[model samples]
Target: MIPSNKPFFDDTEIEYATASIQSGNIAGDGPFGRKLENKLSDYLECKHALLVNSCTSAIEISLFALGIGPGDEVICPSFGFVSVANAILQCGAKPVFAEIDYETMNLDPAHTEKQITTRTRAIILIHYAGMSCDLVSFSELKEKHGLYLIEDAAQALGSKLQGKALGTFGDSGCFSLHETKNLTCGEGGIFVTNDDNIAQQAEIIREKGTNRSSFLRREVQKYTWVGRGSSYILSDILAAVALAQFEKIEPILSSRTKIAEFYQNAFAPYNYITPPTIPDGCKPNWHLFALRINKLHRDIFLEKLKSKGIGASFHFVPLHSAPYSKTKLKGGNVSLPVTDRVASELIRIPIYPQLSNAEKESVVSSMEEVAEELGLE
Candidate 1:
């Protein structure tokens, strides 16, 4: 049976990983780790890139670096992964959930504006499925309100908007290199920023609130305890794997895009489901190929896929309506109609660079058969 997600790896990945082991520098920020930092900064075109342990840690550090602490609130979409909100909560801040645009499934700047209050200090924009949200509007909103813009670009390392990289558009951007992501290092992440101040602070925070980075650069005689911080560093072993993946980004992105396009063309004539949408000037990494089907038919459709030896699944449940959020939110229960609707209707198909042409065709064929059987066509 075809799985919903699988990591792609090659001989280069194994070779780099093995070399890292032989180098006897498996610690954090070693040679391979520094290489990854430089490579990612060059590729993302950001002034600074700090490798981290996980995307969750990347978000937490970004929040801490921006001074978003207790009594502050952050605006985020309820339709996204829970990490953004979890990061906010971890920093003793509140996450004010906002509505997402029905088409893009990204934070709607208009709705975001309404969610903002005096306590709101930042806005976390998540580029869902590696597709960018409306960058211009959010940038304007951040400036007008004097709020920090943090990008949860976990799925969008290679995605861009208006020819500019997605992560660079915000004050700080966090990216994941998890096994399931387009870019992988087994488990790792990156923190990016062009602002020198944020970059400096993030370095300290990532190194357990110490000035070790400065000491290493000869900027200081010795490192000392600094402010609030944590050990969010990614090891050289993982960095070695990530470096190999970075070198092959172009091919990985091309392979994924080819599959996505094939699926789009195959589903074009069917009104039974809607394919993924890409707004003008946006180039996605095709991290996920999600389709929208009738809410009523979603369950049976998933079951049919399973019976056909296909592993299909739905995306997130609206965070606002989650049992945990229902109890934690101060404002009783938040209402996000679009997020709720999309959560029930959306289904993600298997997508990975390693998927063969025949496997992709079979996935589409199985979906078509299921739709027909359900009288969706």
Candidate 2:
């Protein structure tokens, strides 16, 4: 079967990881880790980049470093990964769910502005499917309200908007390097920021709320407990693997771009399905290719694809309607019309750098057949 997603890796990752292990520095923030961070900072053009264990950890650390806690409300799109809301809740903050624009599956700037209030401390903007949201409008809102902006750039490592990197626009940005992502280190993440104060605080928070980072630089005679923090650092071994993948980002993104273009062209003839839209001046990494079926049920389409040995799946279930968000966060009855519609109609097909041309043709042909069977075209 053609899998929904596959991470690309080769002997280069193995060699780097083996070297990291042999160097007796498999701990966090080692040489490999530092190198990876430097590479990320340089590529993203951000002042500081801190490696963390997961995107969730990066979000949590960013929240802590930004002084977001109890009594704060963070506005985020309900149609996204549960990790965003969970991280907010973990930091003693309330996650205010907002609607998304059906076109890009990213937060709707107008609707997001409506959710802001006196208690709203920040807005978490997710670059859904590696396509940027309306950063210009969001930046205006940030300036108007004097609020913090955090980017959930988990899928937007190489994506850009108006010539600026997606992760660099916000006060703090988080990225994922999970096995399923475009870049893979098996499991890892990074936190980035341009603010000097936030960077210093993030370092302290990542190092278990101590001054150890300073001590390592010999700026402090001894390290000690400094503030509230946790062990959010990524291991050197994982960093080595991530560095190997980082070196191949251009080729990886190029391969995915070609696959996305193929999908766009292949599905253009069918009026029953709508392919993802790329906004003006927004360059996507093509992390995922999600099609919105207007007539057929998404599940039926997915099952048909599966029966044809083509792996297809649905994306996120809206967080507001999720069990935890409903029962615990009292968001069960939230009315996010676009979020609900997109969640039900959207289906993800296989789009990975490792997907061969033959596999791509097979997937497209199978999808076309399924659409015909469903009387969609």
Candidate 3:
């Protein structure tokens, strides 16, 4: 059966991991971890990059570093991964759900600006499906309100706009290196920022509220408890694997881009489905190719793909409508019509760099047959 997601890896991953094991430093934040951190900083062209256990931890520490708490609220899209909003709740802050641009599946700047209130301390914009969001408008809104911007760039490691990286546009950017993501270390992530002060605070919070990072730098004679924090560091073993993947980022991104373009062109003739849209000046990493099918036929399309031994699936349930959000999220219930509609109609076919061309053709041909059988013409 063709899987919906599969991570790409090479022999280099095993080689580096073996080296890390023989080095006697399997703990977190060791030599390999430091090396990976520096590579990420240079790749993203950001001033600081901290390798963490997961994207969730990266975002949580980012919010904490910004001094967000209790009375403050963070606005994010309801159409994204739950972790985007969960990070805010973990900081004792509110998560205000915003609507999305149905075309790009990213946060809609107009709808987002409307969610802002006096309690809003930050706006977390997720680059849905690896496509850069409208950073121009969001930057304007951020400046107008004087609020912090955090980018959930988990799926957009190499995505950029006008030559600037997606994660660099915000105050703090979070990236995921999960097994299913474009790059992988089994499970890992990184937090990035340009501000030195925020970077220092992030290092402290990631180290469990201690000044250990400073001590390691020999800037301080001794390290002690500093503030609220957690052990968010990635294991050196995982960092070693991540380093190997980072070295081949270009090939991985290029392959995925080719697959997405293939699907886009193949599905364009079908009137019942719509391919993903990449806005002008945005270079996507092609993390996911989420096709919006006829709302009435979306469920059947998934089942048909599965019956044919292909793994096609839908993405997140709108967070606003989730039971947990109903009770936990402040400002009561919200009605994001666009978000709800897109969530129901969207379906992702098997997309990975390793998918063979014949396998890709099989996926598209299967969909075409299914579409005809369902009278979707």
Candidate 4:
């Protein structure tokens, strides 16, 4: 059976990782780690880039670095990954869940603005499926309200909008290098920023609240506990693997884009389903290829695809309705019509870089069969 996703790797990754291990420096922030950070910074054209253990860690560290803590509220899409809300909560802040735009499955800028309040310190923009949200609108809101804009760009490593990288638009951008992402190092993440102070604070926070990064540069004679922080750094071995994967990003993105285009063309004639929509001037990495089907048919459609040896699945379960959020977060139980609708109707098909042409055909054919069986549209 085709799996929902798979990490694409080869001998190059193994060689790099082996070399890192043989070098006797498997610890965090080592040579390979520095190399990966530098590469990411150059690619994104950001002033600073720091490697962390996970995107969740990157978000939490960024929050702390930006001074978002107790009594502060962060506005985010309720239809996104739980990490966004969890990270805000970890920093002693409240998560004010907002709505999402059905077309892109991203936060609705207008609804997000409505969620803002005096206590709101930050707006976390998640680039859903590597498709950008309305950055212009969100940026305007940020300027108007004097709030911080943090990008949860976990799936947007190669995505760009209006000729600029997606992650660099915000004050702090966090990316995931999980096995399922286009680029992988088993499990790692990156934190990037253009602000000098945020970069310094992020380094300190990532190093467990110490000035070790400064000492490493010989700028400081000794490093000690200076502030609140955590051990959020990534290992050199993983960084080595990540570096290898990073070098192959263009090909990986190219492969995924082809698959996404194929799916879009295959399903365009089917009135029963709606394929992902890309806004003008937005260049996506095609991290995920999702279709919006009838809410009543989504579950059975996934089951049918699985039975046909095709890996298809539903996406997020809107955070506002989650048991934890409903009970723990204030205003979390509030109504978000768009978020609810999209969560129920959305279905993600296999679109990884390693998916073969035959596998892609099988997925499309199986979906067609399922739609026919269900008498869809």
How displaced is residue 87 in candidate 2, in Å? Answer: 0.8
lDDT score for candidate 3 against the true structure: 0.91
Model 2 regions lying over 4 Å from their true place: none
In order, candidate lDDTs are: 0.91, 0.92, 0.91, 0.92
TM-score of each: 0.98, 0.98, 0.98, 0.99
Off by over 4 Å in 1: none
Q: Write the per-residue lDDT of candidate 2 for residues 263-346, one digit (tens) a residue.
A: 999889888888899989999999999889963468888888999998898988889988887778854458998998999899
After TM-score superposition, the amount by which residue 32's alpha carbon in candidate 4 deviates from its true location, in angstroms, is 0.8
Models, CA RMSD each:
1.0, 1.0, 1.0, 0.9
lDDT of 4 by residue, 235-348 (tens): 999999999999999999999999998998999889999889997799999999888998889889988888998888888988999999878776789999888899899889
Whole-model lDDT, model 1? 0.91
Residue 374, candidate 4: Cα error in Å is: 1.6
What is the C-alpha lDDT profile of model 1 across 1-377, one tens digit per residue?
99988888889989999999999999887888888899888888889999999999999999999999999999998888889989999999998999999899999999999988999999999999999999999999999999999999999989999878888999999999998999899889999999999999999999999988888788999999987799999989999999999988999999999989999999999998878889679999999999999899998989989998888999898888888888868862688899989999999999988888888988999988887788778
Of candidate 3, the 10-residue stretch with the lowest lDDT total is 324-333
Off by over 4 Å in 3: 330-332
Q: Candidate 4's error at 131, in angstroms?
A: 0.3
Q: What is candidate 4's CA lDDT for residue 223?
A: 92
